[model samples]
Target: MKIKGLKQLSRTLEKAGQSGFRTEAAKWLEQTGTDFLDLVRDEIVRAGSIDTGSLLRSFKRGAEGNIWEIEKGGLTLEVGTELEYASFVNDGHWTGGKEEVRWIPGQWHSGRFQYDPGSSSGMVLKRQWVKGTGYWEHAFYIFERLFEKRLNERLQTWLNSL
Candidate 1:
């Protein structure tokens, strides 16, 4: 994920320095939030898949100035997407939730045109039972695993930089 508006973040940190405790807290939170997003994006790309690029692109950091204010970052670090189908890519269908059954109406045209036996033309009702196996391919979970392995080294580097 490409994080935008760091020039503004610098100004935010400066303002936070002047505002005392609350702003200082905001500054720390913003840093951690942005870093976490970057880490997730890196992990997603490294994991690599057909939809991984789009998924990485979907991860966004709040605008820099907004990072220090309640309207955007501050206590509200928003790092997600407007992409409607993100859930489908993250979690394979029917795997994220419990099993379900859907009842579909019987129709003549649907039966004759769509099926070979055309046995569904009967007036009797039909139910489709969807069994969910919990086939989880969620990239974030992979990222979590990678982060766990690297956490100590990553934290050590960041602390040394400070």
Candidate 2:
């Protein structure tokens, strides 16, 4: 989108802070980020698949200096964590079987022992291949439409003031 009075805005931003280009870009990025996050949350919530409320509640949308990031949960993935599962839900996961094993906590005077899942021999974990729903794609499509429509007006208004 063409932002009117960009040069003027840049100069003003630099005077107010540091890098004007970065500052101006951050404003637009934040606006789009908010829209993206909201639309994505709405889509996921309406789909009623995973816990959209929790996912959306932890959604992150903002810029770090010149970089803009939109993330659903933690920045990094940790095994056995909600964020890991959320990643699987968003992109789907491959079905594979590994020898299943677990440890039973000590009880009374007994010590913990390695437990094999399924019968005496070993059991293969069931595989469930889930197809990706392209949840993010749907949200991006909605966000694009919204930003395309509103960006010009917002930029024009901001420019006028500048």
Candidate 3:
């Protein structure tokens, strides 16, 4: 929420080298997101308070980034690669919704999502508004490596912890 001690953590991560940062981010993903999918599914099937036809909210992770959504609504969450490159798309699908992208400078000032893998990662979601078709985009990304893919690979680690 407050990102409590983010400044301190970031400093320490940078000092320890890129691998340390990845390990830390991966840990965050494992602790927060892994079971969210299952929990939502359970709520839909049993609570009956959620729409079951399609996910009311969905999450996607890759080596480049991560995304969060609420079907037919607005963007809810996002996390991008290690370079701070982000594309947070909220509301509807990209068809008409807007996206917020965060840009991070990587090793040699590169913006590649997976070339280095040691410099960047995060996400953002853009939301849409009814007035004048306005859209709100939230973004957090790192442009160093293919973060989304890495996120996917590490899912099992999260599951194991669960």
Q: Which model scores highest in lDDT?
A: 2
lDDT by residue for model 3 (49-161), tens: 33333332332344223343222223233432232211221232342335654444344435533334455643333453422111112111221133466666665454334
TM-score of each: 0.39, 0.51, 0.24
Weakest 10 consecutive residues of candidate 2 by summed lDDT: 72-81
Identify the candidate with maximal TM-score.
2
lDDT of candidate 2 over 29-109, digit per residue (tens): 665666666676676676664644555555544311112343323332211113445566667776664544433333222
lDDT-best of 1 and 3: 1
lDDT of 1 by residue, 120-139 (tens): 45343334333322212443
User: Runs in model 3 with CA error above 4 Å?
Assistant: 1-19, 49-52, 56-162
Regions more than 4 Å wrong, model 2: 1-25, 60-82, 98-125
TM-score, cand. 1: 0.39
- Candidate 1 ranges beyond 4 A from true positions: 1-19, 50-52, 62-74, 94-162
Residue 157 in candidate 3, Cα distance off native in Å: 12
Task: Report the lDDT of model 3 for residue 52.
Answer: 36
lDDT, candidate 3, at 136:
19
